[model samples]
Structures are given as structure tokens and as C-alpha cells.
Target: MRWPRHVASLLLTAVLLVGPPILLVRLVGWPSIDSPQVALWQWVRDPLTEQNLILLLVGLAWLLWAFVAYFVTAATATRVWAGVRWLRRLPLPTPWQATATGMAGAAALTIATPTAPTPDASHPGTTTTTGTDHDIVEQADTADGVALSGGWLPYEVAEQVTAAAGLVWLRRRRAYRPTRPHRHSQDAQDLAPLPSTVAAIQAATGSRPPPPVSAPAAGLPPIGFPPTGVGLTGPGALDAARGLLITALLATLRQNTVELVITRRAVDILLGPAAPHLRPGAGLRIVDTAAHATALPADARPSLSHGAEGGRRVLILDEPPRSSLANSGATMVVLTAWPHATTWYVEAGGHTRTSDTANAGPRVCVLDTVATTDLLTVTGHLQPPAPDTPTQPQPQPQVRVPRPTAPHHDTIRPDKRVLVRVLGEPALLVDGAALTVRRTAARQALVFLAVHPDGVDSHLMAEALWPGLPGQRLTGRLYTTLSELRTAARTAGLPIIDRTGDRYRLHPDHVDVDLWYFHRAVDRAAAILADPSTAWQAVVDAYAGDLAAGHAWAWLDPHRESTRRHVLYAYAALAAAAPDPRQALAYLQDGIRVDPYNADLHHRAASILTSLGEHIAAADLTDRYTRRLATAGLTAEGALIRGGT
Candidate 1:
């Protein structure tokens, strides 16, 4: 019942071809293979031409042949009709079988029969030509024109010959060249020659060097943003938004560190034209977020409008002000919803309700690509707390700052240490130990280096992490933090090599950053797959652990996607490169599990199953893939309805 459409189509076609012949035999009688001569003679002879005894035998033979053919046709036709009906229940090319059959027949005819040239007016005795008029005339010959082809030619041939001759006749008889009208030299010369003498002053002026050119004024920028009020305007905003969203979706490349997301609709709208350039291996994770059918906010209906631009950064869409909608939390809400992997949280009546309860972490920032303009209005300037703002200490707290009793070197040790600080705080982990970081200035200094990783400039670092601190004071703080961090590392038996001119780098072997591990695995897999023989072992070992457990930082999604993609790629390569079908299927199955949404993966799995003669499994996988796609909101482009059936 769940037979593939192709299989059903084949059965239907076989029935159509075999049924007609059998039915004709049953209704009119066909010659039997066993008694060929008698059957043939009886079939050809007129109904009235036989004796009574012969007629009775012929009638009996005819009846028998009719029964045989009828039974065969009826049985096959009934089975095939049912198959075709079943095929029509799916959303696929159900009737394409008929078209395919027609095409096949046409192709067979074309290949089987050799083409012959059409009869020429001059020659009048060849076959059909698939050439043009000029060619026909050029190739025709009076010598080849023998008796007018047994009888009259088909009407088409006659017309072709007549048309060719007419075209040739027209070519020979046509001519429309323009005549040159005579011009009087006396009248023409006097009117045109206003003199070489007048060129005297012009020559003197032309001999002088041209004045130095001045730079032209810059013109106004083009109407850069999309007129639809989508935040697609700016110098590179459109390009940036696309890259950002794509990167976010495909965070596997970035290990999911970048926080950006887009809706399926957004992907479709932006990527439809550029679909050809979309690389499947680029480690993009574009998930369908169209499942949310929730209504818009109560007070803020999303009205598309533009905002003022901030240099080359902002994309403003100009629109008439909606006074009622102004100042509502529309902008933040919209931007947050713009991304697929997004959820919201609200605190009301002393309780917090979160939309993303399934997600393990709390939400930090929301990026709304919708008509929400709140973010566009937020000025990035950080103003100091008001002068009269009194910072209140916790009511129950009376604390003294803990002073280090041990030497600076001993106090900075790392051992089974857990260092917690703000994102930019300086917390060091040496081996398996953690170092106590001086809160604030010293902690931030360490974090700046960790985040930058490539080594920040000492001057720039001083200015940025400790903005208002004076030169000597800030440098002293930086040194103190560096000392404590180094001491902690040494105590924990870790490596921290200081470089000349105030530079530092973490030892690659000692520090196991997740980002580094992800890249190593991906790179190794890619390398081996490229050569197959070179880095095979490394590739396998690298992808052993996922973005280290419990470390699904929002920023690491891209990296996660990247790592997952490489794993799949490695598996696929292994499958393809393997000589054994069993091994190939194993690898393909693993890849499928990791990247279930990949169409090519499904195709590969199905192919491997089919190759292994697991037809049922192959069919089932295909059905599963089709259903999965339908669930993702992609409707079939065509209906699979059997035409004749």
C-alpha cells in the first residue's frame, strides 16, 4: 500500500501496455503459441468462408483465446489500478509516469529511425530534412530529381519544398540599395569652410596647459535602506544582517558564540535568490521558527516605520508617527522575535514567567528584526549614576575585605578551582585549579585578555579596561592583577609565559578551550576527508566530545553547529570512501542522526539502504523525509494524482 510512486507508476505502465493486447485477444481472439498455424488461419479467414465442421472448431478456438486474454488483462489491470490509486494519495509527481513513458517512446522512435533529408524543389526525391530553407536549396540537385516519388508526396513535404523554393526566389529577386544624391562642390564647400585662419587664436589658447583640476564635492548618500521599513539600509547593513543571521543559524562555524537568529520566512525572503551560492558545508543551522502562532502584543501593534540613522551603523525606516503606539515595548519585543532560537521572560505579581522554560539558561539580550523600534532609539552612551544616587549596602551585611595572608605568588594558586566573574572579569584556571582574582579592575583586566585571546595592545588595554585611571596607577593595577594570576597559575602547576613588551599568551597544551577543541576536530576532519590518508585518526579523535558538556553558552551555538557539521561531514566521507556497503550504511546512519534535516543526508541514507537491497527501509526513509519536510511548513509543489486512473 505504501509502495513508492515510481514503483506504482511502473506497475501502472506495465498494465496499460499488457492489458490492451490481452483484452483484444479475449474480445476478438488471438493465435495461440501451441497451435499457431490453425489459430493464424482461423483468425485471418472471413467469418463466412468456412465449412460447418471447420466453423465449429474455429469458434471454439476463438472462445478459448478470448477467455485467456480477458483473464490476464483483467487480473493485471485490477492490481495496477489499485497501485496507481495509492500513489495518488501522496503529494508527489503521480502522473509523471505517463509523461515519462511518452518521452521514452518519442526518444526510442527518434533513435531507431534515421533522419532523411526533405525533398528539394530542384532534386524532388530525397526524404524529410530537418534543416533550413537555404540549406535545402544549397544541397538540392537537378540531377537527383528523378520520377516524382512513386506517387504524390505527403502534404507537409510538398509545403516544405514549395516554401524553400519561394524563399530562394524571393532572395534572388530582392534589391533596395540607396542611390547617392549629387552635391554641388561650390555650394557645399563655401558653407562649411569657416577657416584655418580663425584657428590662430584657438591654437595659442590650446597650447597653454589646462588649469589644475579640483576635487568634486561628495554627493548625498543613496536611498540606502529598504523602502519597506525593514532595517536593511546602511553602508553594509543589509550585507551584515544577512551574514549575521546566517552565521547565527550556522553557529557551528562560530561554535554558537554569536547571538543572532532569523525566522524561516526571513531566510526564504533573503536567501531565495542566492540559494545557489548557499553552501551546505558552511555549518549554518537555519531552524524553522514558524511554530509560534502567537498574537502580537496587546498595546503595541507592529507598525512598520523608519528611525533616524546613527552614522553607518543604524538602518532607519521613515514612517508617519503613530502616537498611540509610541513608547510601547514594541521594538524590544519585535527584535527578540526576529531570531528563531528566542524566548521571552516577564516578572509579574512577584513571580517570573518565562517563554523559554525548555532552554537551560536565562535570556540576556533580544534582537528584534521586526517593526520594533525601541532598540533603534536606545543611545549607546553610558551616563554615570546621578550625583545624589546613594549606593545602599545590603541591610543584613557587615563585611570586611579579605586580605591575602600568604605571599602574592602562593595566594594566586589554582586547584579544583571554580572562578566566577562577570564576562569581562579576569579569572584564571591553572591545570584543574582556580586563582582568586581581585574583583573589579584586576579581574576585568584578565578577562579582556581571555576574550581578545590574540593579545590586546598594552596601551589600548590600559585605556579601555581602566578608562579614567591615571597612567601610573592603571599600569600598577594591571601589573598587580598579572602577578596574582601568574602566582595562582604557578601554585596550581600551570603554564603562563610572559612575553616581551608587556604581552602574554596562554600555553596551548595547558589550556583546553572548547573553541580550540571544536576547531581542531573540524579542521582535522576536513583535512583527512580532503586527502583521506593523511589525518584520519586525528579527525576521529577530535570530534569525540560535543562543545564540552553544560557549556551551551548562547555565543557558542555557531561553534556547536560547526562542530556538528564536521562530524556529519566526516561520517559521510567515511561512508562514501568505504568499500563495504555495511560500513557505508553504518556511517550514513550516524550522519543522518546528527543532521536529520539535511536532504542530501536522507538521500544518501535511502540510496545506501536501496543498494543493500533493503527496499522497504529505503521507502520508509523516503516517506519519513517527505513528512518531516511537510511538518516544517514546506508545502509540496505538485500533487501526485494519476491522470488516466
Candidate 2:
């Protein structure tokens, strides 16, 4: 398939060259040749005949036709080959392309975006997103970072979260497809991955990870060099530079893969307010120096010789470096082309010419300031508190709660119950039958409601669902999720959700939550009631696990951690109440397993062991707890010598 055009061109040329000669031969056989020993005198005797003249004309015509055929075929083949090569060289779009662009990003390009469809009130069916939805939005198993959501997260934001999800997928890849840095000497006019391999894999696997669409003019490879100098200049220099910066930061989705070293002023110019939240953090360092406006960080002595090869520290600047960063072992990317050696000379329409090849590179990715700012908000960047945030009160039960049309609208009630479980892996069961929530947003909405029992106001819900995303941009998605949830409630004969004005809350009468049970038990244990130990036991029994234990919903951290502490408290209370030393030790051990870094649980267990004449066991528990806490970035109260010894 790759050379079909080549093959066809070859055939056409062959016919053109042979066709005329064959016709000439058929009409009058091939001309006979003789020695030209007496050529001038011999020509006079043979040339004047009618037969000789016809033969001369035919032979002359064949020679002219063959000459024309050769040049025509050569020209056509050269152009076709160039087109084919360029197509094969095209790269796949970066993962966060659409998400980063955002609704505001539409201004970056002139092409009109299709009108967003109105939210339909029909089926809660499986919706398709251009393969970006394939990312799993749970937290890392180590329980380190927040679980990121998909759907409406800004591209820059998605780049990090989605990249994290992609990282997990990559680690699970059956084969390693190493991405080599494109060398300056070569155009990287590389062929696409073989169709045979992809087709075979596609046939064998189901679409949990969607298949990559291979097109020749799809995307441009991110400009990543190994701690070296590159320049971007042309009409699109600024926009192209923005794209590179975004990509470099996104590479951190692999965690410590790339470190972007930038000056505070450069950050202010490039990112503005977003500069603070995304900086002074992992994989990005903001340097403070009064040396020069374009100087590297004062303390940044990056290793180029013997350091992390896969992990790169890319230092981007407004002007070319006076000192070679390569000697110091870090990448230096400049905003101007022809800074000495022309690396990339891009045009206004995005056509780029690179030093690597004479051919023009594909349309390189670009980002305007607005798009860059928008994406930076979500990606490795944190959200600063909004200036004009509304202080809307939580939805109160006394207010009028309007339900969507149900089995009987007048008789609408939580008369039938649906059990929503979020204490562990979230699940919904209506009338004892499991109801599968298909859309990720809808399920997340359900979990969001379960956590905020008092209900979330419209703006809060929108911002929480897709942080920093404009409500107008997410109107369809929000509507779709809420509409489907409403439809599900109606179908199940339960008033699961109640909305008044712009506030949405789960119906207290109809929907039962396991978290409610956990909270109640916790409240009872904390109360001044008699036999609080029994209440503590109830608390421990009620907590199946942390809230939405597996998924890394970014918003779930506080609630999850808070709930976990209550469980630890409950366990400690139960252990204290136990009459037997062995029973108390058992309680402590169970609590330790639940929260390994809980110093109190470990100490209590250790104390019990020591009193029972097991000093070695106490020491071992202390050592283990110390290490666990240190690993999780916590300070262990009793384990001081852990660092040195």
C-alpha cells in the first residue's frame, strides 16, 4: 500500500516508452542498420525513396516519444514519492491536544468549530470521545497523588493526568516502542508503524485502549532534544515556543522524566498568574537571579556527562545563552531562529522548515497565550482561589426540591431506596439490583454528591468537575451527566437527586449512602455517651475502607484522609477498651495494617508487646513504622535515628 502509487507510475512510464515503439514496429518493421564507411555517398543512393522517407518519419517519431516519456515519468514519480514520504513522516497528535486547546483555544486557529449539540434527555448511553477517554481516572496505587478525572479537564491539565494514566498503560505495554530523539542531520522522514503489526494487534484486542488512527498529515513530533540548543523563529515563533513548553512540562506525566528550568520573569511573560502554582514543584524549578534577564539559574549546575539520560532538564530562554548549557549538561531552547545555526524557521500558516531536511516539516503544534494559560491551570499547575467566587449557601432540605417526571410525578418520593456505596470502591444498587453508571462524568457526579451531602452550588459543581473550565464550555457535559442521572432515577422509581435553583443535592429520603452510616458511627464514638467503646467498635465495622478507595478523584483527598483518621481513632479507642492485653494488641495490629504509617497504632502495639516481655518485637515494629512514615513523606514521632542508622 505504501508504494502503490510508485508501482502505478512505473507501469505508466513503461507503457508510454514501449507503446510508441511497438506501434512503429507493427506498421513498418524496425529499421535495419549498416556500416557508415561510405556514409555521405551511401546516403544519396538510399534516402530519396518513398519507403525510406516513411521509415525516417516513423523512426524520428519513436525517438521523440521515448524522450518525452522518460522526462514525464521521472517528474511525476519524484512528486508522488515526495508526497508519499511526507505522509508517512507525519506524527500522531499529542495526547492532550484537544483538552489543552479548550473552548478558548478555538481562537488560535481560523477554522470554525462545529456547534456544540444540546444535551439530549434520552438514553444514558455509552458516549465516545476521540480515544482520550481511555485514561483511567483513579489514583496511583501507592496513594501518593490525587486521582485525576477526564471528560472536561483542560488539555494542559489532562496532559499531566492523562499522561499519568498513559504511563500506567505504557508500563503494561507488551513491547517497548522506544522514542529516539530526532537527529539534526536527518529529516526523520520515518515510515509509519507497520500495518501488519497494528492490524494483528487490533484483531486480537478489544478497544479498552482505542486503536491509533494513522494519517500522513496528522501531527508534528514534539521538539525534544537531548540537553542541546534549538531555535524557533519565523512568524509563528512565539506560538510554536508555547507548544514546546507545554509538551516539555507534560513529559513530567511520566514523573521526573523532564525538568523545565525557567526564570521567574520568563514565567511571568509565558504563564502569568499560573506561573506560581505550577512552579517550585517537581519537574519544574523557578530560578531567582539578578545576573541577567536571560541567565540560567544560579544554582542550576545540571549534569550532561553522567546523569539521568531519560530525564532531561530543558532550559528555555528569550535569548541565546552566552555560555554553552550543553557543557553544563542541560537543554537550552531559544525563541529565535538563526541564532547561529538555523534549527526551525516556521511560517505564519504553521509550515516549518528544519535544518534536518530540505523538505518542509508538518504543521507544528502551536498555542496562543490564552490557550497556554487555560491549559496550565489544569496540568501540573494548581488553582489559586478565584477572586469573584460566590459564597452560595449549601442546599437546605426545607427548600422546595423539584424532581424530574417519575413513575408518578405527584407521588414522587424516596419511597423506594437506592444504596450508594462510596466508603470503598463506589457502587450504586437500586432496589438491590446493580445499576451500572456508564458515563465517567455521571458516576463522578454521583460520587461528588455523596461526599457533599449538603449539596454543591452550580459554579462549584462545574469547577469541581472540570477545574478552571468555563461553565459555558462544559454546559453540554454537565447537562448530559445530570440528565442521565435524572433519567436513571425516574426509571428506578427513586428520587435520587433533588435540584433547586442552581444547587443540586442527593435526596435524603430516597438515596441511602454507606458514608452516612460511617459518619453516624464516628459521631456516636466521639460523643459523651456511655460505653463509647461499643460505639467505637460500630465505627470500625461501618468503615469498609477509605472513601472511593481506588479512584483518585482530586477532590476526594481531604474527605478520604479525614475519614481515615476517624477510623484510626476508633481502632485506638477499641484497643483501649479491651479488657485482655492480647485483645488490645489485636486491635492495634488491625489498625496498623489499615494505616501502616500511623505512629500511634504502631506504638500502642509495641507497648503491648513490651509489657508482655517481647522487647525485640517492639523494636521491629518501631523500625518498620519509621520507614513507612519516611517513605510516605511523614515524620515518625518515636523514630529519630532512622535517617542515619
Candidate 3:
């Protein structure tokens, strides 16, 4: 229940501000007044006396202090209660806010109480004084005034009252000072302007001006603006230019294309669906370090190294090389993402050179994507070069030798196949070595296929993998995941999964799946029911644990439970066919261990124990089973065993 705001404010005022002064006055043996109102009236009527005058001043001061304290406390209480209501909706404990408020109140009380002074050797008699000199002076002055006025209250008492009141007032003011909230202007200037194509090129290449365009000759049409096609505005213009530049560079490099050294991540990004198609036949070399690039075979084709190169050959760096290309005997050094707009670095005469103009040399071309595209388009229209004259063949001496018969080789040894285990924790073993398949979707696909040997169609696979995704998105993700799985399989020297139409499957001959073996053992045991001991034991041994025990997929639960039921059946068959009672009891116990809640297995074990003359043990087992069933909110299916079975 909550009280009215005025009532709560009045209560708080009486307890905190008015009560403290009243208690202090009482402590000094001041006349005990039952009613605060009567005390105030008595003080007003008898103001001539110093005692009454002091009381009247203290009461009026307290009334003023209470009024201010009441409003401040009421405002703070409203805010705190609102916060409490908000906190209650969260997951926090119920009493936390109250506990926090209590702690804060205690802290305020501690700060309000002045620390008593420690004894000093110079002044041995004044050990109980407060530490502050102002407090001591105030107390001394109050005591002297009370004595001079011949007041009813003792000097020490008056001094104590004044000190307590001053401390309380100071503490209250310090704890609650109202201030206006700060406001922010909506028109604040931005610290930095947005980046633009011109700004980016200038920053990269330095403050050089753009190359001047040559005027067209007389009777020739001026190079009017190339068709302003779609995706040629704003930042997209830079992207389109970059794309064309890359295409031109690749085309030029194809003339003598040798080795292409790039980072794996960069290769993936550049070769993604959105990037331009790269011409085939370039020696695609991926390296994780610059050191690897330096050690590449020199006999390989002309190289475009992402960083520095060691050989004295034409090196096209995608970005500026860390070391200067000067005196390196490089035929050409093309730097992309140049630091300046008008200037670029080049290599010529076995030294690195800087050019501020576009017509510096045939070996240098520092142009953006659009410029590169325009140059390539113009060059493509030129006529073919004249054919070179062929040289006449010269005669040379030759020796005749007998040719030796060579042995013919036909079949090659196959690579070690992949073995996937999903009976327990999912694992992929290639050639007896564990292969870490990091992608979660790829792993899930493998596990799903392992359980369903006769592959699942793409539609069903999609539903299982991404349950709530849209159809188009689901199809795309499924294809990407399947591609990743096939790549991983091939890289590990395992047979790639084959897809017949929309159905994807791993060949049984190449992939030995553990789930298949478990099901095979169970099938064999069912076929040989006459003497099923060996077959059933094989079934038990093949099942290491539940299917995909560690992976959490909703679809996996059904497969896990199905596999578990098969194991339970095998255990039950072995127990019923055992010749000895003890052996049968052991089999039943094993079945119970696999599934503790199987009341049938528990009953069989108990019956075996009773047959062996262990009546007490059998009864205890039955009691335990009964308790388990009750705990699971299940009624016992059979009568509970007493002393005898």
C-alpha cells in the first residue's frame, strides 16, 4: 500500500529533519515538551529568556529545513519508485532495489556524522572534540554564550545541539543539489567531410593534378562523353572503374601470364559472383605470406605479386611495395591505389622513377578504372600487326640408336577413402587421420547423409538445414554448402559427393559410414534368430553411443531414438536366449544401463535375481523402479514386488 505524497513527505520530514533537532534538544535536558506545536507557541511567548529564544530560533530553522527536505525527498522518491517499477519487469531479484537504496542511505548517514577527534599530546583534556577546527570554535562560542546568558540549558548541551544541527543541514544540502539538464544543439558541424572519389584518389596519389586531355585533330570527331551508363554515378563510378581496370590488367597480363600470387581471402573476394570473370590458364598461386611469394619459381610465367618481388623482372604490384623498386632492373612496376592523384611510381633504366604526367613512357600507365577501360576499348579497334618472315632450316649431323622396349603401366593405386563416424560425437576421418570440417552447415550435411545412405533431395535438405529461410535463399545456401562439402572432400583425397539431378549422395564404396555398420549388424542379428548371440554382440559393439550425441539439431533426435531402440532390441534378444540365469541377468542389466526408464528391462532383471534366490535384492530393485516411475509421473504397470518376486 502507498500513502499520499503529502503524508509521505510529512512523515519523512518529521523523521529526518525535525526529529534530529528534537532529539538533540532533549539530550541537553531542555524542558520536555509533549507536543511540537505547544513547544513552538511557548518559545514564541517567552522569547525574552535566552533559553526560549534559542529554542524558538532552532524550531523555526528546523521548520524551514523540513519544508525543503520534504520536497526534495518527495521528488527523489517518485523517481526511485518509477525506476523500481521498471526494474521489476526485468530478470532482477525482487529486493535488490530496496537493498541498494538502504546501502545508499547508510553511506549518507556515515558521511553526515562528524568524526570525533583523536587525543593529542599537546592538549590532553580535549579528546572528544570533532576533528574540524570550525566545529571546535563553534562549540566554544555556543558554550560561552549560553553561560553568559544564564540559560537553563548547560553550555556543553547547547554546544552539542548546535553542532549536530549544522552537520545535518550541511549533509542534506550536499546530498541533494538540483541542477538543470544539459542540452545539445542540433546544428553541430561535422568533424570531417564525407570521402569522395577525387578526395580518395588525391589522398592515395598525393596532391598532383589530373593529366591534361589532348585536343582532337581537325576533321576528327571530339571524344564526347562515353555513354553515361547505369551504375556510373557517385561512389559506384569508382567501383565500376576499379572493375574495368582489373579486367584490362588481366587482359594485358595474359600475353605473358605466368604466376599470380595472391592471398586466399583476396582470391575468394575477387573471384566471387559479383567480380569480373578472370581468364583461365593463369598459374593461380595462393600464399599466406610475402616470404612464400619471394621463393616462387622464376621459370614460371610473368608474375603479379601483391607485395614485393625478388627477381629482376616486370613486377605489377596491386598495392605499393614496402621497399623502393629503384635499381631493381624491373621492366615495369604498375602501382594501383596510388598515393597521389597526378603522380605515380615507375621502374625504368634499372631504377625506380616518379612521373607527374601521363605520357611519361610506354612502360608506365597510372590510370583509374574508367581510364583503363577507355584505353583498352580504343586499342581494340586497331588493325593486326604484319607477319614476321620465317627463317630457312639448316642441316645438322644425327646419330642412329636402337630403341629399347618400355614396360606398360595401366592402373594406378587409389587414395585412402573417407570414414565418417556419427554414432557418438561427429568426426570425419580421411585415411585414418581426423579431418577438421570447420563449417557448421557442411558438417550438418555430412551427418545427415551418414544417417540416410540413400541421399536426400535438395528440397528436403534445405528444409532440414534452414527451417525458416525463404525458398530462394534456402536454395542458394544449400548449393553453397554442398559445394563447400565437395571441395573439402576432394582436398582431403576423398571421393567428391555425386549429385544425380537434385539428389546428393556420398558413394558407399568410397565413404565407410558408422551408422551403416550399426544398421547392418542389427539386420544380420534379425536374420539369424536361431543362434543370434554372435550377431547381437556385433550389433552392441557397433553402436558406440547415440547418433550425433554432441550436435543439437531437432531433426537428429528421431534418428538418435531410432538407433537407441535397435540397440535395446539387440540386448533384449541376447538376454532371452542366454542359457544361464546369471548370464541372462547380466544382459538385462546392460539393457537397463542403456535405458534406465525401460520398465520391462528392470522387471526382467528383478525376476532373474529372484530365480537365483536373491529375494531381498529383487524386492529392492522393484522398489527403486516404482519410485522412478512415480518421479516421472507414471503409474506402475505391474504390481510392486513384496518379499518374494
As a TM-score, model 3 comes out at 0.35
Native-to-model Cα distance after best TM-score fit, residue 356 in candidate 2, in Å: 12
lDDT of 2 by residue, 542-587 (tens): 8888788776554444455556666777777778879999999998
Point out the higher-scoring one by TM-score: 1 or 2.
Answer: 2
Q: What's the count of clashing pairs in each model shown?
A: 43, 7, 11
Worst 10 residues of 1 by lDDT: 371-380
lDDT of 1 by residue, 100-219 (tens): 978998889887564743333222122342332210111111212111211111122222223322222222111111111121111111112111111111121222222222222122
How close to the true structure is residue 80 of candidate 1, measured as C-alpha lDDT? 99
* lDDT scores of the candidates, listed in order: 0.37, 0.55, 0.47
Query: Clash number for model 1?
Result: 43
Among all windows of 10 consecutive residues in model 3, the one with the lowest summed lDDT is 222-231
Superposition-based RMSD of candidate 3 using all C-alpha atoms, in angstroms: 39.0
Candidate 3 on 162-186: residue-level lDDT in tens? 3322222222222221111111111
Reference-based TM-score of each model: 0.28, 0.52, 0.35
- Name the regions of candidate 3 deviating beyond 4 angstroms: 1-416, 626-644
RMSD of 1: 40.2
